[model samples]
Target: MIVLDYPYVSRFLTDSVLELGQAVLDTPQARRLAGDAPLHYIDEIEFSARLALGGKVYTNSENGLGHVLRCRCNEDLARQIDICKDKALFRESVAALHPDYRFRRVPFEDLAGLDAPDVDYPFIIKPTRGFFSLGVHVVNTPADWPAAVRAIEAERAALNAEYPEAVVSGGEFIIEQSIDGEEYAIDVYFDAEGNPVITNILHHTFLSADDVSDRLYYTSARIIETWLLPFTDYLRDVARECGFRDFVSHIEVRVTETGDIIPIEANPLRLAGWCVADITALAWGFNPYECYFKELRPDWDAILTENQGMATAMVIGDLPSSLDRTRIRDVDYEGFQSLFANILELRKIDYHQYPVFAFAFVSLPETELPALKQTVSQDFTRFVVTE
Candidate 1:
């Protein structure tokens, strides 16, 4: 059975699917498929959207393939998955569990409610269905709230102009009390039988100027057995309580000064980008891409045997000056990749166009983290960005 996986975005899936098929046609592998019959088109997004919008349904058809395996599903599940971007429903579900998780909804017309009392300054303001950090802002005080609100308003106006029909369906913005602490992302996968499996845990290191706080990068590993493993039960309970079953999820949490692990947000899908896959492989000897392809090899099990003796970190370089006007070609990226001698695995380059950030995963002896970071800062210039 041919499974045509399209980009996750519903609007771009058609073009992305056609482009993927065309790329396949240009490859040498396509010649080998010349004798095969017509390719069976199985569009995941279309199928999902049909179930979501058209009130259609689907069964899992197989076990161990996905958490949704062999299940009866409806439009509600699909709509919830699609419309509640960034697992907003999960956050709302968990919020109901606590009395102190109070949040004030700020409307586009009147954003003054965001300045309510007991509501701490420097809190996070984000669209209810936002992705990435698109329209998110951290307002430090009452003085900062107006500017943040105006910024979001300007962004919404721009989006409305570009896609007039696609109005912002969720009119409210969420003003959440920020959890001050070190930020970490945990990637969890559930088996077909409904077991909470910890795939990887990544400590996101923010790389930005003192003036800019939103830009961030991450590195991950399977060896997060120190403080993470002990909290797996808590995370699992949170996931199950939120109605998340067989799927990949990225959970971000903060370990506060009081030693409480507060849930920040959750994304109910594969963690975007390659840095995650690179770090997971470097530390555990198996890449999650393999799991995505349903390979299910014995090496997947080897990750469980991996110990938490080493510390792995990902260093992201500043955007190259020449990237704005030029396209990078024939990049001899080996110089950057070769710097880490202890790197067990290397994944593909993952970066967005504008920021031009690049990630590399390096494994260091747990005791040598400080010196390693210093060495990286000293030696990072060798990876040149060329036009």
Candidate 2:
């Protein structure tokens, strides 16, 4: 069973639904986003019935989490969602895995009052429940604390109005010590027996330590060959500790210098947002949706051998916060694509309603990794036309 919610959906997903014959929960939002596509639509009753029967559940956006909660299908399903969505709870559940990791949850009202001397230097502060990296800031020193608080305050109202509190809330914020290492975002689902089945792994690249934007995520045969086994082992530990089964999650983690995989957080019931999961299809020759629904695990050994030198990436064209979205006239998508070497697909988004201009899936030579990094730091304002 799948629940589609606001923001965006993709042609790849709809095609997957048609191909897999997956039942989408019939909601107005789903109908509108999905259009008149001949998808198998199920009513609320059937949705709940299927869920109660222990059918697999997946949601494209956390906004649809409310519908999943209301269905009350499986107790563990609800529990798993709660634990994954709440950063504090998620930290506690997996504390045994990283006993030395430091973290604390502070109410939004008290964020400004936190004693600077008491906090560990250079920690990350973000909404307890957040999506898309909004309100995420790295406080390197006491002087940076005020700026982080003000930034959160500035975005609070817009955040509340733009996203449901379930998807993103400013009620509470989490302060945790930053993990130092290479970061990666993974898409995986646990089977009925709580064994994790890995689907795709993308290396998340950032220009600087303090940069927190959905700028670039790329994967290659080398990445999969290197981290697939270790990440699967890490997920198994997470599943065992959290009692997760028949659950799908898009998880972010950091691999330390010592080769330890420390989880950042898990976005429940989906791969990447705005159908970035399609990067899997662009990179590999399979649909991630089909992989999950049919429990079709990738033959990693064969896959790695076949695609040894190629790399795939999802590059987000996010509008800078300084730009006034309402005044934007148009985006020169062609101008932006000129920056990349090869674009597999260019998904243009309505920046007037959303902050992003588009999501580009690109195929590049693994040797051109530095070019991908350079593309992330380019001044995207040149591509926008403002009144």
Candidate 3:
């Protein structure tokens, strides 16, 4: 039984989410992630749209979140790839791939003491199982640890309120000396034959030098075409080195000034929600979801043969919760359009009161990119809400 994690689906790009559901319909022996023998919800609109699109409704039920692998992957493969979810394990696994790729990790328990000291300036502390950048902090100096820990404590409480089922254990964390550089993410797909394909490389935007909150990410088809082949080849090596096969993953990396790619975080079975994977569709013609099941293994030869041009997907980060827990009350809309004129679609996922992420998809010519990046970061509320 396939069980689409819910209320969870409500948290993503609905267009791409529906495309994913359609892929399930295309896959043989697949069913919705929420049914029990022909009765399951398709969230917002499985009944109407399914009927309109001539989609099938499968009601076979599956219980327990542990069965998530049954939704689209084999059990062994899922477990193998999931280890990367633990940020600590992820660092070891990636560093194992090559000595040059290095990340220092320390348990949070080690830092809880008052006397143990002298950590370098500009370090990061994040939950071992963090999501959406919650409980992530930057320690700019020795004096910042107290406030940083307090912030993590507050974030832990807010996260517990948002997701009670999966609590963040305070015992473990990966504290790393921060690295400098522009950050990026690569969406990976393995063909049914185990060949890894780098479908998209996202250019990320941050609020400031110490800002760990994930703000914006964008990628274009034309940009992907210009990337060096060795980068993808290196990713394939990382996959093989880590013992992952036949999987979909979003690998986060930092590109240093010298242009070396450094892999930092790994999320298995697709990019983090909000349909970041849909950028693949915005980049190439097919959304990553449709490509995954409909093709099972993507047909890169045919896709590249089409020689698609410029297109981009933008994912804007949610406003960070205030210390007082305030809601967003304002947005700079005119500033947004003026800064990024190529926006095709722009909207907030949740209202200012609810405070979720916002996104846009567009295709801007190369000439405007430098200004786009600088202006967007400088004007924080231009496209997103501010608390």
Best candidate, TM-score: 2
* Regions of candidate 3 where Cα sits further than 4 Å from its true position: 1-3, 6-75, 100-110, 114-121, 164-171, 294-317, 323-339, 352-354, 378-387
Per-residue alpha-carbon lDDT of model 1 for 20-93, expressed as tens digits?
34212111222232224333343445444433343212111111112222132453343334422433455667
lDDT of each: 0.48, 0.89, 0.56
Q: Which stretches of candidate 1 lie over 4 Å from their true place?
A: 1-73, 79-88, 112-118, 154-172, 192-194, 207-223, 272-275, 287-308, 318-354, 371-387
Local distance difference test, candidate 2: 0.89
Give the per-residue lDDT of model 3 (tens digit) for 1-387.
Answer: 122432233223334445454423222222332233333234323333443442322111111123343343344554554566677787777675646543455565565564423455677778776656767788888777888776665655555455332324444677776777877787766654556777667777776788776666766545566553656777777767677765666778777778766777777665545455655665666655555444444566676656554546474635546512254555555555555667766655543333454566666765566666665565344345446
- What value does the lDDT take at residue 208 in candidate 2? 90
What TM-score would each prediction reach against the true structure? Answer: 0.64, 0.98, 0.73
lDDT of 2 by residue, 1-387 (tens): 789988898988888888888899999999999997998999999999898888887888888999989867778899999998998889999999998999998998997777773567888998889999888889899888888888888988877666799989999988999888999999998888999998899999988988888899999999999999999999999999988888899999999999989999988899887888888888888889888999989888987898999999888999888899999988899999988878889989989888899888889899998967887799898999999
TM-score of 1: 0.64
C-alpha RMSD between model 3 and the true structure = 7.2
